[model samples]
Target: MPANTANVVAEYKDPADFYNLINSDEFSNDVGQMLKSFATARTVPGIYETDVSPKEVFTSPVSEIFRIKIHGDQAKETTARAEWENFTKTLNGKKVLSGVSINLEERLFLGIVGWESFEVSRLLNPFHWARKLKFTGSRKIP
Candidate 1:
């Protein structure tokens, strides 16, 4: 079993800042290098033990997906919409779900009210937030 199996989620307050970072040359170059590394590894025989090739894992056409919803004043929303459109155009064939709304329920569900409350809740009932442990195979297979 892999010991480093954790996923991180990033939240950005401003849409333009997010777009700007992703569209920057540094970010683009890093992504390109990662894809190139995957492609290069596919050429090495017996490098990947799995059934799926590196190309299949990295170059899948349906991998890129973005869902963005902006909630703010009319002027801010309009500016964000225009920025999102420009960003999507650069993405080419990627799937993008875009919308603007001011739903209090949705905000309540997604937003973290306070770190203190979050930490206290987790401390009170750790199991409520903990992930279930998964075990595979009775013995190690070399």
Candidate 2:
């Protein structure tokens, strides 16, 4: 594994369970770990922020997915975390996680450096993660 590689997984028991996790320390801990592992040493460039499914965000069958695609050097991790914090802060205590089955996807990138190129693989293991996650309180390490 590369020194800059970092992986993170966010799991919620059920949609209701997600509410609890988001408000609890677990969410913060997970975010913190992601930042700690991926933060870049310097400011990166060519950062692009886009909303994949704009309408689906509020009307999707599954939970909403917020994805960030960045094209830069080592600082991408820190930048990503900052963006994530800003995005999540606007939830306004809404119930964003609720469903019969939840998918807590996790991924680890092994590279020569901390993201030398731009890559987004949220769909890598769609079926696998979707199958492993269920219920309302189980937590798994990624």
Q: What lDDT would each prediction earn against the true structure?
A: 0.32, 0.32
Question: Residue by residue across 34-114, what tens digits does model 2's lDDT show?
Answer: 565566574221111222212223332223233322223336445545544443445443223221112222221111111
The clash numbers for all candidates, in the given order, read 0, 4
C-alpha lDDT (0 to 100) for residue 105 of candidate 2? 29
TM-score, cand. 2: 0.23
User: Which clashing pairs does model 2 show?
Assistant: 13-136, 15-97, 15-98, 40-74
Q: Give model 2 RMSD, 1 decimal.
A: 17.4
Error of 2 at 101 (Å): 21
Relative to the true structure, candidate 1 reaches a TM of 0.26
Instruction: Point out the worst 10-residue segment of candidate 2 by lDDT.
Output: 108-117
lDDT, residue 37, model 1: 44
